[model samples]
Target: MPYLAHIGPIAAIVAGVLILVMPRLLNYIVALYLILDGATRLLR
Candidate 1:
């Protein structure tokens, strides 16, 4: 649970850096993020 709290910000930071490097990946990154977030919440 404690580690779960850190997953979000870390994911966001990584996503942000990725988007910056490849603007075209913005959509995919966002979609993946949303899907992962949803799955994690559901599991909890």
Candidate 2:
């Protein structure tokens, strides 16, 4: 599978859990995720 295919599900699960456990982290998680995703794509 392509990296993005894995990223979606993993990010979703992590974001979901984090949102439930620590709502404050939602923004950071999303920002980190986008940054990582963009970096990954650019680096690839």
Candidate 3:
């Protein structure tokens, strides 16, 4: 539970790096981030 608090910032950082490395993956990364964010919020 404590580690779950860090997931958002960590995921954002990873997504940002992935986007910078492969611009074409922007869409997928954003979508996946959104889905995960929504799922986490819903679960909470």
Candidate 4:
């Protein structure tokens, strides 16, 4: 499979695991994701 095809699911699983392990990190993770996502969209 192409790497891009796997990225979404893998990212979700990793994020879920991180949240489960460190609930406190949820805010940071979400904020970072939003920033990165917005940056990518703007760049594109």
Among these predictions, the greatest TM-score belongs to 3
Off by over 4 Å in 1: none
Which parts of model 3 are misplaced by more than 4 Å?
none
Which 10 residues in a row give candidate 3 its minimum summed lDDT?
A: 1-10
Cα lDDT tens digits for candidate 3, 1-44: 67667778889999999999999999999999999888777766
> How do all models score by TM-score?
0.81, 0.60, 0.88, 0.62
Per-residue lDDT over 1-44 for candidate 2, one digit per residue giving the tens place of the 0 to 100 score: 37655775687688889989999898898898788778666765
- Model 1 compared with the native: what TM-score? 0.81
Between prediction 3 and prediction 4, the one with superior lDDT is: 3
lDDT of 3 at 42: 71
Error of 4 at 37 (Å): 6.1
How much is the lDDT of residue 1 in candidate 3?
Answer: 62
RMSD (Cα, Å) for all candidates, in order, is 1.1, 2.4, 0.8, 3.4
- Residue-level lDDT of model 1, residues 1-44, one tens digit each, is 67877777888899999999999999999998998788777767
| Residues 1-44 of candidate 4: C-alpha lDDT, one tens digit per residue | 35545555666677778999999999987777666556555555
Estimate candidate 1's alpha-carbon lDDT, on a 0 to 1 scale: 0.87
Better of 1 and 4 by lDDT: 1
Candidate 3: lDDT of 44?
A: 68
**Candidate 2's error at 15, in angstroms?**
1.2
